[model samples]
Target: MARDDRAVGVSSFEGQATSAGQASLAGEATGTASASGPHFAAGPPAETGEPLRHPPHGEGDERAGEVSAGGRGRPSRAPPSLSWLLFSRLVFPGIFLASGLAGLLTLREIVAPPLDMPRILSGLERGGSARAEALTQVHEAILDPRYRDLKADPELAESLIRVLETELRQPITGSPEFTVAYRAQLCRLVRELDTPRTVPVLLIAVECRIADTPQLDSPIRRAAAEGVVTALERHGPDCVRSVPGGVAALCRAAKDPVAPVRAAAAAALGHIGGDEVCDLLREMLHDDTDVVRYNAAIALAYAGRGTGLDTLHEFLRSENVRNLADTGSTESVIGDRTCKLLCRALFALDRLCDRSTEERLAVLHPAMEDLCLSRAPEEVRTLAMRVDLKIERFHR
Candidate 1:
């Protein structure tokens, strides 16, 4: 019986090895065995034969037991646990399936594309119902902060602005929240997209001063003004328009007690200058504050027309007299800025003047020489050289 038991154990070990090898071959072909095969190293046999009893004990029973145990050792096999099988077959496959499904969903969204109002609006009327609906979708998207990140997408930004314009046209009581949210979204879009569409909306927002409530005025108005300035700076003359009340507000801002408001207005006027801008700048040239006058001179240089040259020349001569009177010891930076402004104004005037080449050269030569040779700031020298070169080229 002992010999039979030993033979059976050896046969069981051989059978197990053969089964493992076959399973490995199948796994290599199907790819499933790679993860599961390692676990079978300690797997139990497919069948457990009847238990074998030990030989009867005698005087040398201890020695005999040791010999028998050593000669016919059974292979160690760990019992298969349901938990391990479930993890191997069910849990891992579930994770892979979930990841694949997620990828598919993402691909679907990308291929189908989202609604893009800016592109749609390119072919639709600004005030039409189609545009309004598109804008509404954008407005809804932006009201959530998550859409803020989406602003990086140009199409999304365009849609948001279209919606914002529609909201602006509605009555104030219609949905103040929507109006305010739309303006906020417009502000973000202008800063993010900095496109032409944002320009008109920014101007309208500034002109409307939508934040009538005291609590809302300071932050919202400041942001709107900044947006308008940014739009103009980025897009230049094309984005500028001469709204009836727009110039008036800017003109008032030029004289505002607050220096920043005044500066912003001066910059805006320079950006959108016309006959009206020239007039406003001329009046401000005589302002009580030298700072205001200095800015006015700069604006005049930027917005100047044919007569603008003569007016700036007079200011330059007046500033020269003022500088001489002070003996150049004044701490007021405005005086220095005024001198620079005068130099620029002279340059701008030289560009627009229709005098003979000789006459233009004679008029501009002194200022050009002073700008180059004197300790004038680099900007002044640069502008002077640019003007001089332009004049030379024009004559050529």
Candidate 2:
């Protein structure tokens, strides 16, 4: 009886196993299996709550074998590598921050300009459109109170002047704007300051005639000429030679049809003492315009070149003869004044003449005797006596 029971139990177990295999095969065929365990089971389903779908042959299992090899397929839960995160978040912002700071600093420099003499000089040396722009900025800066104080510093002033001179010499070809701007600035500086320190610089600018560009408008040239005059007055003859082409320019102006120009030239020549200047004065003495002649005489006398004495003496003698014929007391008075100027000129010439003592005495003796014996003013007699004594002593 026990052997029988054992056989029945074995059969029952076999039957159960067969039934489970059949169920698994049916579930797989129907595509309704929960892929939770090795074998299919009829239960609540997997925690993922989905049925397993088998792929066809030669096709991959998308859920089980698919991979996001290059981050293409699925989203990831883990944070990216620290370096990558830093590159994404901090790198660009840091760069932008650095750039912003630099830009701000540059803007500040522009808004509140500094002297920056070296930089300004460098820009001026470049001498192009950029140089022109830099020069304009420098001029504006100079007018600013911040840089206005720099004028008090002689070294700074000299450096600035040198920069301007360099710009004038540079061969920059472009618009006339730079040229105009440069002349205006120089004129302003010269007019504003009367310091001896500025004298040499203004003289250099004048001598070069750097302001005399083809594009110079009328007002600009006038301003530049005025500056030249101021420099001439302040520094006198020594500064004239230091100016590059100053003497030649003034000599040319001596022939200008404009009376003021001729007058200014005469005055400039007077301030600039030289043998060449004396010749120019002598030429001016013969000018048709009395005003020109008068200025020339005054200038030549002031210069003490004494080259105009003979011309002045002839003019005075002619005037006297005309006065005698016309019986014009005014003409006579004018002649008397001319005689005085002539005597003074002769005395000056006697002193400067390179001739021997006997020759100088021979020339001066007649003029001295005439003035001493003439019914001239007391001042004239006194001046004649003084000149005679000088001549006598000089001869001895």
Each candidate: RMSD: 20.9, 28.5
TM-score of the candidate numbered 2?
A: 0.34
Give per-candidate clash totals.
1, 0
TM-scores, all models, native as reference: 0.39, 0.34
Q: Which digits, one per residue and each the tens of the lDDT, describe model 1 over residues 325-364?
A: 3454325676565655555465555545433333434355
Most TM-score-accurate candidate:
1
Instruction: Predict model 2's lDDT versus the native.
Output: 0.59
Residue range 151-261, candidate 2, lDDT tens digits? 465554555566656655655456666655656566566444444455444434433333344334333333444565566666666566765676777787677655655
Q: Weakest 10 consecutive residues, lDDT, candidate 2?
A: 321-330
